[model samples]
Target: MSAGSPVNLVVLVEERSADEALRALLPKITPGVAFRIAPFDGKEDLLRKLPHRFREYTYYWRAVNSRVVVLVDRDDDDCLELKAQLSRMAKEAGLPAEAVLFRIVIEELEAWFLGDVPAVHAAYPRVSLDLVKRVKFREPEDVPGGAWEALEHLFQQHGYHKKGLAKMIAARDIAPHMDVENNRSQSFQVFRDGLRRLVSEEN
Candidate 1:
């Protein structure tokens, strides 16, 4: 938050874990900026409601001095096509492109945890960064198979969370430990940049 640039941010997240992660991460990123999380049941729900939501937000935010960031997982879709689709949705919603920002966490939110190996270590404490370092995808965010599943498998092999991953717990444990400056995921870079741009101006 820059001096005199008051911002109210509405984060439209795809999952509960995303909501939990952003709830912890955003305030650390933008101190003094007012923001709230609007979590969807999942990716499908977010896409289904996005057009209407954008239209409603356009009208409502005008009175509240606010802006919105729509966050989703790319999830096997063509990233360029997905972004263009969202742009079209916003335009059809009667909202200007400048009024809202869209960001995709490629694969899924957990890939972000893999991006910052130290954060993952800090969260789980037993997983070795060396194991994460040896994965085929150099950038974990670009992993083809579900990133969350990969993370679960890793932990499961190591005798942690044998039942299953609790997404909320994983998010809460890892997000606060993420080092913003050290993450290698391009998607994380885009998200960070988008947030900065969104809050750079006075609402």
Candidate 2:
């Protein structure tokens, strides 16, 4: 691809919130490798359509330079089992392994925001800078009582999203200020590294 040409990276996400978060984050990591995020109504919807999507992508794969990433929240499911299912679907669709990357968020997208307290603080000035020093939040993926609930409580304490967490809004506010290199969430780090590796392999 030329300096100005679009990068052929495609990211398939479970919800608008994931899309919103990645919109701000991908650019930071990918730099000149422009990407596209395709969000489904929800995880179930994405899984329902993934097989067909993979099949259709055969055209894109043959006709253009491209890669697809399927990202989902692990929720209450077994992470390894979920990954195996996704891999099976992609393989059944006959997609080359290099053409797709499947990633499962440990609990949810909010964990990524919690990964970098500085980013959250930068976006919400009321959020305490000392938050990361606390035991509960020091580990983003393992945030006590779950990531989404922890973030909701934190945001509420900071006087934002008092009426429950508005995911897309939170993503919009927090993601732009996130530092890719400084995130402490192991899952987020894996995602960042995997995406960079995928993009680099194309060159």
Candidate 3:
């Protein structure tokens, strides 16, 4: 696609927490990408809200005109049905299955902060079961406090070694911290800046 074209992203999340986090992270990770964050209160909401017509709109209008479409969803069992439905919708829309991406973050927004469980524990020697569980099963109300603090601790405690699986975890964990409404607009800006720096040094 041409540089002038916008990168269209269709993100589906089970709760407000995941929605807000995806909203915060996408633009930062992929600059100039235009996104729509659709929040489903639950499995029923997703099935009812995302009709075949919307799928057509996504495929024909947005997909055709944009550079890419990144679809993010949670990995709960309830979401399995939705995933299959989306896949079929994508095919009907004439888009390649690969063109419709999935970032199934296990156990919702907390997964962003904790990364993979074993990796997180390895990084933080003092982590307790409560802290671990909280990070793994975080709700919307669970955010805006210790969540960000824990993530910051992860980065600091790990010495900011941004590479390999560790870097992936760091990026995923730090991404959700930017979802505070006041900070949303600047999320993409900060992420893009950091990504650029990382890429430059890597090369």
| TM-score for each predicted model, relative to the true structure | 0.90, 0.94, 0.47
Cα shift from native, residue 102, model 3 (Å):
2.8
The C-alpha stretches of model 1 lying farther than 4 A from their native spots are 1-5, 135-137
Better of 2 and 3 by TM-score: 2
Per-residue lDDT tens digits of candidate 2, residues 7-73? 4888999999999999999999889876889999999999999999999887667466678999999
Please give the TM-score that candidate 2 achieves against the real structure.
0.94
Per-residue lDDT over 77-127 for candidate 3, one digit per residue giving the tens place of the 0 to 100 score: 545665677667666656554334433333334434443334344444444
The C-alpha stretches of model 2 lying farther than 4 A from their native spots are: 1-7
| C-alpha root-mean-square deviation, candidate 3 | 12.1
> Candidate 3: what lDDT?
0.46
Leading candidate by lDDT: 2
Deviation of model 2 at 12, angstroms = 0.5
- Candidate 3, clashing residue pairs? 112-173
Better of 1 and 2 by lDDT: 2
Instruction: List clashing residue pairs in candidate 1.
Output: none
lDDT of 1 by residue, 65-92 (tens): 6788999988779989999998999889
